[model samples]
Target: MNINLTLIGQSITFLAFVWFCWRFVWPPLLGVMQEREQKIASGLEEAERASKDLELARRKAAEQLKEAKEQAAEIIDGANKRANQIIEEAKNAAEAEGDRLKAAAKAEIEQEVNRAKEQLRSRVATLAVAGAEKILSVNIDAQAHDDLIEKLAAEL
Candidate 1:
Protein backbone atom coordinates (compact mmCIF):
# COMPACT_ATOMS: atom_id res chain seq x y z
CA MET A 1 0.00 0.00 0.00
CA ASN A 2 0.99 3.63 -0.50
CA ILE A 3 1.92 5.71 2.64
CA ASN A 4 -0.91 8.19 2.05
CA LEU A 5 -3.49 5.39 1.76
CA THR A 6 -2.26 3.78 4.97
CA LEU A 7 -2.47 7.12 6.80
CA ILE A 8 -6.09 7.64 5.69
CA GLY A 9 -7.16 4.18 6.93
CA GLN A 10 -5.44 4.74 10.27
CA SER A 11 -7.24 8.07 10.76
CA ILE A 12 -10.64 6.47 10.05
CA THR A 13 -9.92 3.59 12.43
CA PHE A 14 -8.86 5.98 15.24
CA LEU A 15 -12.06 8.06 14.86
CA ALA A 16 -14.23 4.93 14.96
CA PHE A 17 -12.38 3.70 18.11
CA VAL A 18 -12.92 7.04 19.88
CA TRP A 19 -16.62 7.01 18.98
CA PHE A 20 -17.01 3.48 20.40
CA CYS A 21 -15.26 4.38 23.65
CA TRP A 22 -17.45 7.50 24.19
CA ARG A 23 -20.70 5.63 23.47
CA PHE A 24 -20.18 2.39 25.39
CA VAL A 25 -17.03 2.18 27.61
CA TRP A 26 -16.70 5.65 29.14
CA PRO A 27 -20.31 6.01 30.48
CA PRO A 28 -20.35 2.67 32.32
CA LEU A 29 -16.82 3.21 33.69
CA LEU A 30 -17.69 6.69 35.01
CA GLY A 31 -20.93 5.40 36.56
CA VAL A 32 -19.06 2.59 38.32
CA MET A 33 -16.39 5.02 39.65
CA GLN A 34 -19.06 7.39 40.99
CA GLU A 35 -20.90 4.52 42.68
CA ARG A 36 -17.63 3.31 44.28
CA GLU A 37 -16.90 6.84 45.51
CA GLN A 38 -20.37 7.11 47.08
CA LYS A 39 -19.93 3.73 48.80
CA ILE A 40 -16.56 4.80 50.25
CA ALA A 41 -17.98 8.10 51.55
CA SER A 42 -20.94 6.33 53.18
CA GLY A 43 -18.58 3.80 54.78
CA LEU A 44 -16.44 6.58 56.25
CA GLU A 45 -19.55 8.29 57.67
CA GLU A 46 -20.76 5.02 59.25
CA ALA A 47 -17.34 4.45 60.84
CA GLU A 48 -17.39 7.91 62.43
CA ARG A 49 -20.84 7.31 63.87
CA ALA A 50 -19.75 3.95 65.31
CA SER A 51 -16.74 5.62 66.94
CA LYS A 52 -18.99 8.17 68.63
CA ASP A 53 -21.28 5.41 69.93
CA LEU A 54 -18.30 3.53 71.31
CA GLU A 55 -17.11 6.60 73.15
CA LEU A 56 -20.58 7.04 74.67
CA ALA A 57 -20.60 3.40 75.83
CA ARG A 58 -17.19 3.82 77.48
CA ARG A 59 -18.37 6.88 79.35
CA LYS A 60 -21.45 5.04 80.58
CA ALA A 61 -19.33 2.13 81.78
CA ALA A 62 -17.04 4.46 83.69
CA GLU A 63 -20.03 6.11 85.34
CA GLN A 64 -21.44 2.75 86.38
CA LEU A 65 -18.10 1.76 87.89
CA LYS A 66 -17.99 4.95 89.93
CA GLU A 67 -21.52 4.37 91.18
CA ALA A 68 -20.69 0.80 92.18
CA LYS A 69 -17.69 1.93 94.20
CA GLU A 70 -19.72 4.52 96.03
CA GLN A 71 -22.44 2.01 96.81
CA ALA A 72 -19.90 -0.47 98.19
CA ALA A 73 -18.41 2.21 100.45
CA GLU A 74 -21.83 3.19 101.68
CA ILE A 75 -22.66 -0.40 102.54
CA ILE A 76 -19.40 -0.89 104.43
CA ASP A 77 -19.88 2.32 106.37
CA GLY A 78 -23.40 1.35 107.32
CA ALA A 79 -22.27 -2.05 108.56
CA ASN A 80 -19.52 -0.51 110.67
CA LYS A 81 -21.92 1.94 112.25
CA ARG A 82 -24.36 -0.83 113.09
CA ALA A 83 -21.64 -2.92 114.66
CA ASN A 84 -20.47 -0.05 116.84
CA GLN A 85 -23.98 0.62 118.03
CA ILE A 86 -24.48 -3.02 118.94
CA ILE A 87 -21.25 -3.13 120.90
CA GLU A 88 -22.16 -0.02 122.85
CA GLU A 89 -25.54 -1.44 123.72
CA ALA A 90 -23.97 -4.66 124.91
CA LYS A 91 -21.54 -2.78 127.13
CA ASN A 92 -24.34 -0.77 128.67
CA ALA A 93 -26.35 -3.89 129.41
CA ALA A 94 -23.36 -5.59 131.01
CA GLU A 95 -22.72 -2.61 133.27
CA ALA A 96 -26.34 -2.52 134.34
CA GLU A 97 -26.34 -6.24 135.13
CA GLY A 98 -23.17 -5.88 137.22
CA ASP A 99 -24.71 -3.07 139.21
CA ARG A 100 -27.83 -5.08 139.92
CA LEU A 101 -25.81 -8.07 141.10
CA LYS A 102 -23.69 -5.92 143.42
CA ALA A 103 -26.77 -4.35 144.99
CA ALA A 104 -28.36 -7.73 145.64
CA ALA A 105 -25.17 -9.10 147.23
CA LYS A 106 -24.87 -6.09 149.56
CA ALA A 107 -28.45 -6.46 150.68
CA GLU A 108 -27.89 -10.15 151.45
CA ILE A 109 -24.74 -9.38 153.50
CA GLU A 110 -26.59 -6.75 155.58
CA GLN A 111 -29.43 -9.16 156.33
CA GLU A 112 -26.99 -11.82 157.52
CA VAL A 113 -25.21 -9.34 159.86
CA ASN A 114 -28.51 -8.22 161.39
CA ARG A 115 -29.58 -11.81 161.99
CA ALA A 116 -26.27 -12.65 163.79
CA LYS A 117 -26.62 -9.60 166.06
CA GLU A 118 -30.15 -10.57 167.08
CA GLN A 119 -29.06 -14.11 168.02
CA LEU A 120 -26.19 -12.82 170.23
CA ARG A 121 -28.51 -10.45 172.09
CA SER A 122 -30.98 -13.25 172.85
CA ARG A 123 -28.24 -15.57 174.24
CA VAL A 124 -26.78 -12.86 176.53
CA ALA A 125 -30.22 -12.01 177.94
CA THR A 126 -30.95 -15.68 178.73
CA LEU A 127 -27.61 -16.12 180.58
CA ALA A 128 -28.11 -13.01 182.74
CA VAL A 129 -31.59 -14.14 183.87
CA ALA A 130 -30.35 -17.63 184.94
CA GLY A 131 -27.40 -16.18 186.94
CA ALA A 132 -29.70 -13.76 188.85
CA GLU A 133 -32.10 -16.63 189.74
CA LYS A 134 -29.28 -18.77 191.23
CA ILE A 135 -27.73 -15.93 193.26
CA LEU A 136 -31.01 -14.73 194.87
CA SER A 137 -32.51 -18.21 195.59
CA VAL A 138 -31.58 -18.68 199.37
CA ASN A 139 -32.39 -15.12 200.63
CA ILE A 140 -36.11 -15.10 199.73
CA ASP A 141 -39.27 -16.38 201.61
CA ALA A 142 -41.99 -18.11 199.61
CA GLN A 143 -44.29 -15.01 199.17
CA ALA A 144 -41.30 -12.69 198.53
CA HIS A 145 -39.82 -15.17 196.03
CA ASP A 146 -43.05 -15.25 194.15
CA ASP A 147 -43.22 -11.43 194.09
CA LEU A 148 -39.58 -11.12 192.87
CA ILE A 149 -40.07 -13.67 190.20
CA GLU A 150 -43.09 -11.80 188.94
CA LYS A 151 -41.02 -8.52 188.89
CA LEU A 152 -38.12 -10.15 187.04
CA ALA A 153 -40.38 -11.67 184.49
CA ALA A 154 -42.01 -8.27 183.92
CA GLU A 155 -38.58 -6.60 183.45
CA LEU A 156 -37.53 -9.23 180.98
Candidate 2:
Protein backbone atom coordinates (compact mmCIF):
# COMPACT_ATOMS: atom_id res chain seq x y z
CA MET A 1 0.00 0.00 0.00
CA ASN A 2 1.19 3.62 -0.60
CA ILE A 3 1.93 5.75 2.48
CA ASN A 4 0.23 8.85 1.04
CA LEU A 5 -2.94 6.85 0.26
CA THR A 6 -3.03 5.39 3.83
CA LEU A 7 -2.55 8.87 5.34
CA ILE A 8 -5.35 10.27 3.17
CA GLY A 9 -7.73 7.43 4.29
CA GLN A 10 -6.99 8.03 8.02
CA SER A 11 -7.55 11.74 7.64
CA ILE A 12 -10.91 11.22 6.00
CA THR A 13 -12.01 8.74 8.72
CA PHE A 14 -10.91 11.18 11.51
CA LEU A 15 -12.87 14.03 9.93
CA ALA A 16 -16.04 11.88 9.59
CA PHE A 17 -15.74 10.77 13.27
CA VAL A 18 -15.31 14.40 14.50
CA TRP A 19 -18.33 15.54 12.44
CA PHE A 20 -20.52 12.69 13.84
CA CYS A 21 -19.58 13.52 17.46
CA TRP A 22 -20.29 17.22 16.89
CA ARG A 23 -23.71 16.56 15.40
CA PHE A 24 -24.96 13.78 17.77
CA VAL A 25 -22.84 13.29 21.00
CA TRP A 26 -21.67 16.87 21.55
CA PRO A 27 -25.17 18.48 21.40
CA PRO A 28 -26.67 16.24 24.16
CA LEU A 29 -23.68 16.83 26.43
CA LEU A 30 -23.83 20.61 25.89
CA GLY A 31 -27.59 20.60 26.54
CA VAL A 32 -27.16 18.71 29.82
CA MET A 33 -24.41 21.14 30.96
CA GLN A 34 -26.54 24.17 30.10
CA GLU A 35 -29.54 22.72 32.02
CA ARG A 36 -27.38 22.12 35.13
CA GLU A 37 -26.06 25.71 34.95
CA GLN A 38 -29.61 27.15 34.77
CA LYS A 39 -30.72 25.01 37.78
CA ILE A 40 -27.78 26.30 39.89
CA ALA A 41 -28.52 29.94 38.96
CA SER A 42 -32.20 29.58 39.94
CA GLY A 43 -31.23 27.97 43.26
CA LEU A 44 -28.89 30.90 44.06
CA GLU A 45 -31.66 33.35 43.25
CA GLU A 46 -34.08 31.53 45.63
CA ALA A 47 -31.48 31.62 48.39
CA GLU A 48 -31.03 35.37 47.97
CA ARG A 49 -34.79 35.92 48.11
CA ALA A 50 -35.04 33.86 51.31
CA SER A 51 -32.27 35.96 52.90
CA LYS A 52 -34.14 39.16 52.09
CA ASP A 53 -37.38 37.79 53.56
CA LEU A 54 -35.60 36.88 56.78
CA GLU A 55 -34.14 40.40 57.12
CA LEU A 56 -37.56 41.94 56.56
CA ALA A 57 -39.08 39.70 59.22
CA ARG A 58 -36.42 40.77 61.71
CA ARG A 59 -37.07 44.44 61.01
CA LYS A 60 -40.82 44.01 61.51
CA ALA A 61 -40.29 42.24 64.81
CA ALA A 62 -38.01 45.02 66.01
CA GLU A 63 -40.59 47.65 65.11
CA GLN A 64 -43.32 45.77 66.97
CA LEU A 65 -41.13 45.51 70.06
CA LYS A 66 -40.39 49.23 69.98
CA GLU A 67 -44.07 50.05 69.69
CA ALA A 68 -44.89 47.81 72.63
CA LYS A 69 -42.27 49.52 74.77
CA GLU A 70 -43.62 52.94 73.94
CA GLN A 71 -47.15 51.85 74.83
CA ALA A 72 -45.94 50.50 78.16
CA ALA A 73 -44.19 53.76 78.94
CA GLU A 74 -47.31 55.71 78.16
CA ILE A 75 -49.36 53.47 80.43
CA ILE A 76 -46.92 53.93 83.28
CA ASP A 77 -46.95 57.68 82.85
CA GLY A 78 -50.73 57.74 82.93
CA ALA A 79 -50.80 55.67 86.06
CA ASN A 80 -48.34 57.99 87.78
CA LYS A 81 -50.39 61.02 86.82
CA ARG A 82 -53.55 59.45 88.18
CA ALA A 83 -51.81 58.59 91.44
CA ASN A 84 -50.66 62.19 91.87
CA GLN A 85 -54.16 63.46 91.19
CA ILE A 86 -55.57 61.11 93.81
CA ILE A 87 -53.01 62.30 96.36
CA GLU A 88 -53.85 65.92 95.69
CA GLU A 89 -57.55 65.24 96.11
CA ALA A 90 -56.93 63.48 99.40
CA LYS A 91 -54.85 66.41 100.67
CA ASN A 92 -57.54 68.90 99.78
CA ALA A 93 -60.19 66.82 101.53
CA ALA A 94 -58.08 66.54 104.65
CA GLU A 95 -57.50 70.29 104.73
CA ALA A 96 -61.22 70.93 104.40
CA GLU A 97 -61.99 68.50 107.20
CA GLY A 98 -59.43 70.15 109.48
CA ASP A 99 -60.87 73.59 108.81
CA ARG A 100 -64.37 72.39 109.57
CA LEU A 101 -63.24 70.79 112.87
CA LYS A 102 -61.43 73.98 113.87
CA ALA A 103 -64.50 76.09 113.20
CA ALA A 104 -66.71 73.80 115.30
CA ALA A 105 -64.21 73.81 118.19
CA LYS A 106 -63.99 77.62 118.13
CA ALA A 107 -67.77 77.99 118.23
CA GLU A 108 -68.04 75.55 121.15
CA ILE A 109 -65.37 77.47 123.11
CA GLU A 110 -67.21 80.76 122.54
CA GLN A 111 -70.45 79.25 123.82
CA GLU A 112 -68.75 78.02 127.04
CA VAL A 113 -67.21 81.47 127.66
CA ASN A 114 -70.61 83.16 127.26
CA ARG A 115 -72.22 80.80 129.80
CA ALA A 116 -69.43 81.45 132.34
CA LYS A 117 -69.82 85.23 131.92
CA GLU A 118 -73.59 85.03 132.47
CA GLN A 119 -73.12 83.05 135.72
CA LEU A 120 -70.55 85.49 137.06
CA ARG A 121 -72.77 88.47 136.28
CA SER A 122 -75.70 86.99 138.25
CA ARG A 123 -73.44 86.26 141.22
CA VAL A 124 -72.02 89.81 141.24
CA ALA A 125 -75.56 91.26 141.15
CA THR A 126 -76.62 89.18 144.20
CA LEU A 127 -73.49 90.20 146.15
CA ALA A 128 -74.06 93.91 145.36
CA VAL A 129 -77.64 93.76 146.73
CA ALA A 130 -76.45 92.14 149.98
CA GLY A 131 -73.71 94.75 150.44
CA ALA A 132 -76.16 97.62 149.78
CA GLU A 133 -78.57 96.29 152.39
CA LYS A 134 -75.75 96.08 154.97
CA ILE A 135 -74.56 99.63 154.28
CA LEU A 136 -77.98 101.21 154.52
CA SER A 137 -79.02 99.14 157.56
CA VAL A 138 -82.58 99.35 156.22
CA ASN A 139 -84.89 96.75 154.73
CA ILE A 140 -84.85 97.51 150.99
CA ASP A 141 -87.94 96.29 149.13
CA ALA A 142 -86.25 93.50 147.17
CA GLN A 143 -88.90 93.13 144.48
CA ALA A 144 -89.03 96.90 143.88
CA HIS A 145 -85.20 97.09 143.60
CA ASP A 146 -85.08 94.28 141.04
CA ASP A 147 -84.90 96.65 138.07
CA LEU A 148 -82.06 98.61 139.74
CA ILE A 149 -80.10 95.40 140.36
CA GLU A 150 -80.63 94.28 136.78
CA LYS A 151 -79.25 97.62 135.49
CA LEU A 152 -76.18 97.33 137.76
CA ALA A 153 -75.55 93.76 136.59
CA ALA A 154 -75.74 94.89 132.98
CA GLU A 155 -73.18 97.66 133.66
CA LEU A 156 -70.81 95.27 135.41
Candidate 3:
Protein backbone atom coordinates (compact mmCIF):
# COMPACT_ATOMS: atom_id res chain seq x y z
CA MET A 1 0.00 0.00 0.00
CA ASN A 2 1.02 3.60 -0.67
CA ILE A 3 1.60 5.43 2.68
CA ASN A 4 -0.24 8.66 1.83
CA LEU A 5 -3.34 6.86 0.50
CA THR A 6 -3.52 4.57 3.54
CA LEU A 7 -3.30 7.53 5.88
CA ILE A 8 -6.09 9.41 4.08
CA GLY A 9 -8.47 6.36 4.14
CA GLN A 10 -7.95 5.71 7.90
CA SER A 11 -8.54 9.44 8.76
CA ILE A 12 -11.76 9.57 6.79
CA THR A 13 -13.11 6.41 8.48
CA PHE A 14 -12.30 7.81 12.01
CA LEU A 15 -14.12 11.12 11.28
CA ALA A 16 -17.25 9.28 9.95
CA PHE A 17 -17.36 7.02 13.04
CA VAL A 18 -17.12 10.01 15.39
CA TRP A 19 -19.97 11.79 13.57
CA PHE A 20 -22.25 8.72 13.70
CA CYS A 21 -21.69 8.20 17.49
CA TRP A 22 -22.41 11.87 18.22
CA ARG A 23 -25.67 11.95 16.30
CA PHE A 24 -27.11 8.58 17.34
CA VAL A 25 -25.72 7.73 20.86
CA TRP A 26 -24.54 10.89 22.82
CA PRO A 27 -27.97 12.60 23.39
CA PRO A 28 -29.69 9.55 24.95
CA LEU A 29 -26.65 8.77 27.20
CA LEU A 30 -26.62 12.36 28.47
CA GLY A 31 -30.38 12.16 29.23
CA VAL A 32 -29.91 8.92 31.19
CA MET A 33 -27.00 10.43 33.24
CA GLN A 34 -29.08 13.52 34.12
CA GLU A 35 -32.06 11.39 35.18
CA ARG A 36 -29.81 9.32 37.51
CA GLU A 37 -28.34 12.48 39.10
CA GLN A 38 -31.86 13.87 39.73
CA LYS A 39 -32.99 10.60 41.34
CA ILE A 40 -29.98 10.57 43.73
CA ALA A 41 -30.63 14.19 44.79
CA SER A 42 -34.33 13.41 45.49
CA GLY A 43 -33.34 10.34 47.60
CA LEU A 44 -30.96 12.45 49.74
CA GLU A 45 -33.75 15.04 50.34
CA GLU A 46 -36.21 12.31 51.46
CA ALA A 47 -33.69 10.91 53.97
CA GLU A 48 -33.13 14.37 55.53
CA ARG A 49 -36.91 14.84 55.89
CA ALA A 50 -37.26 11.50 57.68
CA SER A 51 -34.51 12.41 60.15
CA LYS A 52 -36.27 15.68 61.11
CA ASP A 53 -39.60 13.86 61.62
CA LEU A 54 -37.97 11.34 63.96
CA GLU A 55 -36.48 14.13 66.11
CA LEU A 56 -39.86 15.88 66.42
CA ALA A 57 -41.55 12.64 67.45
CA ARG A 58 -39.01 12.03 70.23
CA ARG A 59 -39.56 15.53 71.68
CA LYS A 60 -43.35 15.11 71.72
CA ALA A 61 -43.10 11.73 73.43
CA ALA A 62 -40.86 13.17 76.15
CA GLU A 63 -43.36 15.94 76.83
CA GLN A 64 -46.20 13.45 77.16
CA LEU A 65 -44.19 11.31 79.59
CA LYS A 66 -43.44 14.32 81.78
CA GLU A 67 -47.13 15.20 81.94
CA ALA A 68 -48.03 11.66 83.01
CA LYS A 69 -45.49 11.73 85.86
CA GLU A 70 -46.93 14.96 87.19
CA GLN A 71 -50.44 13.53 87.17
CA ALA A 72 -49.33 10.48 89.19
CA ALA A 73 -47.75 12.73 91.85
CA GLU A 74 -50.97 14.69 92.22
CA ILE A 75 -52.96 11.47 92.68
CA ILE A 76 -50.63 10.31 95.47
CA ASP A 77 -50.98 13.64 97.27
CA GLY A 78 -54.77 13.43 97.07
CA ALA A 79 -54.82 9.95 98.60
CA ASN A 80 -52.63 11.07 101.52
CA LYS A 81 -54.91 14.00 102.29
CA ARG A 82 -57.97 11.77 102.27
CA ALA A 83 -56.32 9.32 104.65
CA ASN A 84 -55.54 12.11 107.11
CA GLN A 85 -59.13 13.32 107.11
CA ILE A 86 -60.43 9.83 107.89
CA ILE A 87 -57.98 9.45 110.79
CA GLU A 88 -59.07 12.75 112.32
CA GLU A 89 -62.74 11.77 112.15
CA ALA A 90 -62.01 8.45 113.85
CA LYS A 91 -60.17 10.17 116.74
CA ASN A 92 -63.08 12.52 117.37
CA ALA A 93 -65.53 9.63 117.53
CA ALA A 94 -63.38 7.71 120.03
CA GLU A 95 -63.03 10.73 122.32
CA ALA A 96 -66.78 11.33 122.34
CA GLU A 97 -67.47 7.70 123.28
CA GLY A 98 -64.97 7.83 126.15
CA ASP A 99 -66.58 10.95 127.63
CA ARG A 100 -70.07 9.42 127.45
CA LEU A 101 -68.94 6.26 129.27
CA LYS A 102 -67.31 8.31 132.07
CA ALA A 103 -70.54 10.22 132.67
CA ALA A 104 -72.61 7.03 132.86
CA ALA A 105 -70.25 5.48 135.44
CA LYS A 106 -70.44 8.61 137.62
CA ALA A 107 -74.26 8.54 137.63
CA GLU A 108 -74.33 4.83 138.66
CA ILE A 109 -71.94 5.48 141.59
CA GLU A 110 -74.08 8.37 142.89
CA GLN A 111 -77.26 6.24 142.93
CA GLU A 112 -75.50 3.50 144.97
CA VAL A 113 -74.39 6.07 147.60
CA ASN A 114 -77.95 7.37 148.08
CA ARG A 115 -79.41 3.86 148.56
CA ALA A 116 -76.78 3.04 151.27
CA LYS A 117 -77.60 6.19 153.27
CA GLU A 118 -81.35 5.35 153.30
CA GLN A 119 -80.69 1.82 154.71
CA LEU A 120 -78.51 3.10 157.57
CA ARG A 121 -81.17 5.61 158.69
CA SER A 122 -83.90 2.91 158.90
CA ARG A 123 -81.68 0.66 161.05
CA VAL A 124 -80.81 3.43 163.54
CA ALA A 125 -84.49 4.35 164.02
CA THR A 126 -85.41 0.74 164.95
CA LEU A 127 -82.61 0.58 167.55
CA ALA A 128 -83.71 3.88 169.23
CA VAL A 129 -87.35 2.65 169.59
CA ALA A 130 -86.21 -0.62 171.24
CA GLY A 131 -84.10 1.29 173.80
CA ALA A 132 -86.92 3.69 174.72
CA GLU A 133 -89.37 0.81 175.35
CA LYS A 134 -86.82 -0.93 177.58
CA ILE A 135 -86.16 2.25 179.71
CA LEU A 136 -89.83 3.05 180.29
CA SER A 137 -90.71 -0.56 181.33
CA VAL A 138 -94.04 -0.39 179.46
CA ASN A 139 -95.26 -1.61 176.06
CA ILE A 140 -95.24 1.30 173.50
CA ASP A 141 -98.04 1.81 170.95
CA ALA A 142 -96.06 1.17 167.73
CA GLN A 143 -98.66 2.59 165.25
CA ALA A 144 -99.03 5.87 167.15
CA HIS A 145 -95.28 6.51 167.31
CA ASP A 146 -94.64 5.84 163.62
CA ASP A 147 -94.40 9.57 162.69
CA LEU A 148 -92.23 10.37 165.77
CA ILE A 149 -89.75 7.63 164.81
CA GLU A 150 -89.50 8.94 161.26
CA LYS A 151 -88.87 12.49 162.60
CA LEU A 152 -86.09 11.25 164.90
CA ALA A 153 -84.51 9.28 162.05
CA ALA A 154 -84.54 12.38 159.81
CA GLU A 155 -82.81 14.43 162.54
CA LEU A 156 -80.16 11.78 163.10
Name the candidate that leads on lDDT: 2
lDDT of 2 by residue, 80-117 (tens): 99999999999999999999999999999999888888
- Model with the higher lDDT, candidate 1 or 2: 2
Task: Please state every model's RMSD to the true fold in angstroms.
Answer: 6.6, 5.7, 6.0
Q: lDDT of all the models against the reference?
A: 0.85, 0.89, 0.83
Cα deviation of 47, candidate 2, in Å: 2.9
Give me the candidate number with maximum TM-score: 1
Stretches > 4 Å off in candidate 1: 1-24, 120-156
Q: List the residue pairs that clash in candidate 2.
A: none
| Tens digit of per-residue lDDT, candidate 3, span 38-100 | 999999999999999999999999999999999999999999999999999999998999988
lDDT winner between candidates 1 and 3: 1
Clashing pairs in 3: none
My TM-score estimates for the predictions, one after another, are: 0.60, 0.55, 0.56
Query: Better model by TM-score, 1 or 3?
Result: 1
Worst 10 residues of 1 by lDDT: 131-140
Which model is ahead, 1 or 2, in terms of TM-score? 1
